[model samples]
Target: MKQSGNSLIEFLLVTVVILAVTASILALAGQTDKKRVNEELSDLATLTATAERALGMPQGHYEGLPGKLIDEKLVPAKMVDSAGHLQSRWGPVNLVPIDVGAKRLAGYSITYTNVPSPACPLLVKGGPKDKRSIRVDSVEVGSFGNINASALAQACSKATVSITFEHHLNEPGKRSL
Candidate 1:
């Protein structure tokens, strides 16, 4: 019996199926990456917001802790959730993640919320630090997981993200979303 080669339509169908599977896999990976980036941003924002809130705490406010900041030996890490609740006492609040780090945790960085910031580089008529407003630069947040500062920056860069906090104080846009 003469052998018959596979039809063109059959080959095309197989190719299409293979391409579809590959595309789906790629799309899933991309989505996962995006989720990671967003999570990182959210964590960073939370960490910073907590710090700002701490500073805003009424001067006379008192808590059971000897020092409101936590760390008895030093200033504690100002940490809070998105709704404005303190989380950590003296560690990377959420940005670097509690479980992160090998020799150290990955993807972390601290930026100090600038007081009377220079002005939003992207906004117009952004005033000066005293009476003006601008986005905050890098803040001295605690550490990444248990890692140092530089390592955190390296981990977060993969998502084209830079951890930072908003200096929302006595103004309309103080808290982050």
Candidate 2:
């Protein structure tokens, strides 16, 4: 009877230790994810600044901006994989020109696809504030002004999401909203 009681206690202790270790590992993983998300946001900010500089140049347009950025080595090396394709934390990063009107390419849009739902709010909240518009899965959640947190949260409630950051040129060599 005494040996059985000791064995039971040992089993309970080992189970408790296992549970604690699992909890610690989960917490550490959460922290790591947060750190990675912050890194991605920083990279996005750098890319946006680079695009703005390109827009301010003599051409003053977004035509072929993605290729230009890649060819000129303006994009951060970390964002590009071995195949030279831009990648975000969750998936591919696409940079394309935005046609304002009359076949005029006046701006650029950065789209990050296959984004996990939890990262949606973080991306929107931490994204560049000077963007002309922000969209989640083809729905415009914010534009030319402060983004509504509630709207963003609602829009981002999905298994996977796509976020687009659109930057527009108000005039030649000038950025607006």
Candidate 3:
């Protein structure tokens, strides 16, 4: 008499198909998560820079701040990640006022630091005309604040990847280079 269920070969074929489909789904899910994290990082960088510039305008200096930027409302109040860390999808956002100008009135340089895990390098693309486009994994950090064209180029090299929003205390509502 014939067997009542699937043959050995048929059962093995079905199992293999199921495993392959499951693996494909998992791979896609991971990619989607990475994309979401990258987008969140970009948004956080832009928002923090803009808020910091606004905060410094009235003071006429962007350096020697007294408190964490989050307290100043420069960063949105969001629930901490699963790890309970005050950070974006990447990691902690460190804003360092690089160079304070004379009397702190010439507009200071602010560096937005997002230390991504080595597995994921920070990647961002600027406007078409904007020269600050990151195309590689590592880059030399450059100076900001009323920087010269050459300095800007070096700071915004293809190997470098970061977003900088400039605001001069002298010019209200004016976006910086």
Candidate 4:
């Protein structure tokens, strides 16, 4: 009877330790994901500002700005892979020109593909808010200033998602999209 009681206690203690370890691991993973998301957002903002500075005037179009950024070494070295493609933790990062009207470029768009569902909301809500439009999986959720939480939740419910950030030019003499 004494040995049995000791065995039971030992079993319970081991189970408790396992549960605690699992919980700790989960918490750590969540923190890591959050940190990565924040880092990606910061990188995106830096890329936007750098591109704007390098491109000067809109010139009515910003086609191929992604390649230009890569060529000029404007992108962070860590984000660019060996093949010179811009990559994020989830997937590829693409930058394209946003044409307003009559081939006039009003702004640019940054699209992150293959984004995990869990990170979708974080990416959307954490992006630069001024003069930016956000879309999830090709569905327009909201602008930076007026995001709908419900809409975001619905749109982000997927195994993989794509988030696009349309950054309109807010400079002098440039029209905002």
Kindly give the stretch of ten consecutive residues in candidate 1 with the minimal lDDT sum. Answer: 115-124
Compute the lDDT for candidate 3.
0.44
- Candidate 1 per-residue lDDT, tens place, 29-85, comes to 767655543443454444334433453343311222223334432232334435443
TM-scores of the models, in the order given: 0.36, 0.89, 0.49, 0.88
Better of 1 and 4 by TM-score: 4
lDDT value for candidate 2? 0.83
* Cα lDDT of model 3 by residue, 11-62, tens digit: 8899999999999999998787677656665555555455456655555555
Can you list the residue pairs that collide in candidate 3? Answer: 166-176
Ranking, lDDT, top scorer first? 2, 4, 3, 1
> Which stretches of candidate 3 lie above 4 Å from their native place?
1-8, 58-60, 64-68, 79-86, 100-122, 126-138, 141-177
Every model: Cα RMSD to truth: 13.9, 2.6, 7.6, 2.6
- Model 3 / residue 63 / CA error / Å: 3.1
- Candidate 2 residue lDDT tens string, 21-68: 999999998887788789999999988888878664555478776777
Residue 143 in model 1: shift from native, Å?
26
- Residue 108 in candidate 1 has what lDDT? 23
Cα lDDT for residue 52, candidate 1: 36
Clashing pairs in 4: 60-105
Model 3: how far residue 32 lies from native, Å: 3.1
Best by lDDT: 2
